[model samples]
Target: MWQDFGDYILSEAGDDPVKIAEIGVGKFDKISEILSEKKNITVLKTDIHPKDSTVIKDDVTNPNLELYKDVDIIYSIRPPSELQPHLINLAEKINSQLIIKPLTNEDLNTGRVKMKLKNYKKASFYILR
Candidate 1:
């Protein structure tokens, strides 16, 4: 499942050099690690409570817009329900593609913005463009 999610993001990145941000990263970094291996993909990990020096400290509810500037894709893995809407807002404001992998069977809380449900390989997530 994790590989599938990483693969989906890689497909979006294609062969171009792109900047990607992972919001609410928490302690899990497998997806970011996978994406970072690609030379063309620049991965930025952000969380309110960063677990290490590599992960930047940022609150999704009130993110520093400068960090997301020129980012092409923003993805969050299992972000809390309350912060989902804020993710959508940030993606919209930055004009970046948004991907959210909620907990199994957990519906998104994106207000009136309807994100498309995508099934890529064994991964399932919602995408807002």
Candidate 2:
């Protein structure tokens, strides 16, 4: 899943310097560690509860995009199922690409929105534009 997501990030925002905003980043510091290794990529971490560890504290559903106006990609791994719609909405608002690896409880099957699914060995991915 990580490799596939990295590939997608490279292909989607290869030429431009990109800002990647990760919502619901609980204990997953590995993501920041990985993205930080790449050049021209700034990863801003956010969560609902503000802590010294969290870079930004805001809810994904109604986020304050003012601080993240130029974000290029919004990445969420196992975000709450109810907040998936918020991700889709924010992606459209910012003209940014959304990468969501939903949890077991989240259902990606929302008939209102049309999304193309790419199934992988371990994780099934979707690209919502």
Top candidate, metric lDDT: 1
- Candidate of highest TM-score: 1
How displaced is residue 3 in candidate 2, in Å?
Answer: 3.7
lDDT of each: 0.95, 0.74
Per-candidate Cα RMSD to the true structure, in Å, reads 0.5, 2.4
Where model 2 places Cα greater than 4 Å from the true spot, the runs are 104-106, 109-111, 120-123
The list of candidate 1 runs beyond 4 A from truth reads none
My TM-score estimates for the predictions, one after another, are 0.99, 0.82
The number of clashing residue pairs in each candidate reads 0, 0
